[model samples]
Target: MTLPLFPLNTVLFPGCRLDLQIFEARYVDMIGRCMKTDSGFGVVAIVEGDEVGSAPGEFARTGCEARIRDWQQRPNGMLGIRVEGGRRFRVSSAQVQPDQLTVAEVEWLDDQPEKPLTVEHDDLATLLGALSLHPMVASLEMGGEVKGQQDLACQLAYLLPFGLAQKQVLLEMDDPTVRLARIQVLLEQLQGDLTA
Candidate 1:
């Protein structure tokens, strides 16, 4: 499928919500067209270069589809839109238009069948519960209940202070169980560093 790309410094995982402020002419036009057609744009994490300037020099090959959930003209004069992440996709090829917008041919990544949370996931679920209570997370209004392993993994990967590269790795993984296990190890490392 062909998708207009929004390369950013952050990674967006499926089933998560991200609020974006669109100011650039290229993106503003892109978002308008998406909303009109009830289509979505691909959001890829930038590996190099800035979000507001020329097209990013490099970005991850994998990205999430962003479907706009809400939009309004912000008091700051930018278009504020709330988007929910949809499918995962791998970019096969991309090209920059004269307007500097990157469009890509991508293949949707297959999602693993949903698996219920097991005993081992209890700790991770608890941690997510605590994180959800924070003012910032609460403001996103991400529901309090985790539906399954994929839900648990994606939410944690999106909310935690994991590095961009780490989050991107989690996003690309096809197995929810493996993603959760990796997150557990990363969490341990994060705690260890905090104490050291």
Candidate 2:
């Protein structure tokens, strides 16, 4: 399917929330079209480039669909939209419009079966609970409670302080168990640093 692409410096995982301030004419028009059509846009991590202005950039081929959850007009005349990450997809081809809006043909990633929260997830869940209390995280309304191990794994992988590349890796992983295992290792290393 074809999608309007929004390349950002951050990686957006399925089931996470992203808040964007739309100012540029290209995106302003894109959001308007999406809302009118009741469709969503694709969000990819920018390998290189600025979010504003005409900046030549490279973006990851894999990304998530961002469905608008709420929208409002800002006092500064900007569009404020809160979006929740939807399905994962891989971009097959991309084209940029003269107005700097990127559009791409993408393939949707399939959802994996749900897994129960295992004992392996205990530390990561605790960490996620603590992180969720932070003001920035709290604003996303993710809260401490969520359903399924897959959901918890995806959210934590997105919320953690991992680099863009690392987060991208997590986003590309199809298995929640493997993702949680990777997160547990990262969490252990982070905790180890604290004690030293």
Candidate 3:
């Protein structure tokens, strides 16, 4: 299916939330149309270039669908919106519009069936909870809660300050179990780095 794409430097995971400060005319119009039709826009991670001005040179093929949850006009006269990550998708083709919005034809990805969080997930859960207390995270409805393997994985993946490449790997992973295992390794690596 074809989707209006918003390329950003950040990665958003399913079930997580992201806040956007949109001032560009292309995006403002895109968001308005999405809200009007009660649809969603695809958010891709920018692999090169910047979020503002012209098109980013490259973006991850895998991305998330951002559903508008709340929106308001900021004091600075820009649009501030909160969006919830819904489905995952892979962009097969992309086209840039005259206004600079990148539109893509994408294929939706399915999440593995829910898997309950286990003992192995405890440490990650603790870390996720702590991050949720940050003002930016707390302001949103998500980036918290370790309800299941999928939730824990997605939430943690989105919350961690991992660089774009690592984030893209997590987004491309379809198996919650494998993703959880990888996260476990990353968390340990992070812990080791901190202690050393």
Best TM-score goes to which candidate? Answer: 1
Candidate 1 per-residue C-alpha lDDT over 1-196 given as tens digits, one digit per residue, 9 for 90 to 100: 8999999999999999999999999999999999999999999999999999899999999999999999999999999999999999999999999999999999999998899999999999999999988988998887489899999999999999999999999999999999999999999999999999
Model 3, 4-113: lDDT tens per residue?
Answer: 99999999899998889999999999999999999999999998899999989998889999999999999999999999999999999999999989999999998888
Candidate 1: residue pairs that collide: none
lDDT over C-alpha atoms for residue 181 of model 3: 89
Q: Give the residue spans of candidate 3 off by over 4 A.
A: none
Once superposed on the true structure, which residue ranges of model 2 sit more than 4 Å away at CA? Answer: 192-196
Which residue window of length 10 is worst by lDDT in model 2?
A: 48-57
* lDDT for model 3: 0.89
For candidate 2, lDDT tens digit of each residue in 1-196? Answer: 9999999998888889999999989999999999999999999999988888873489999999999999999999899999999999999999999898999999999978787787767777887899889999999988478677789988998888888988998899998888888888887887798898
User: What's the lDDT for all of these models?
Assistant: 0.96, 0.89, 0.89
What TM-score does each of the candidates earn?
0.99, 0.94, 0.95
Q: What is the lDDT of residue 35 in candidate 3?
A: 93
Choose 1 or 3, whichever is better by lDDT.
Answer: 1
Ranking by TM-score: 1, 3, 2
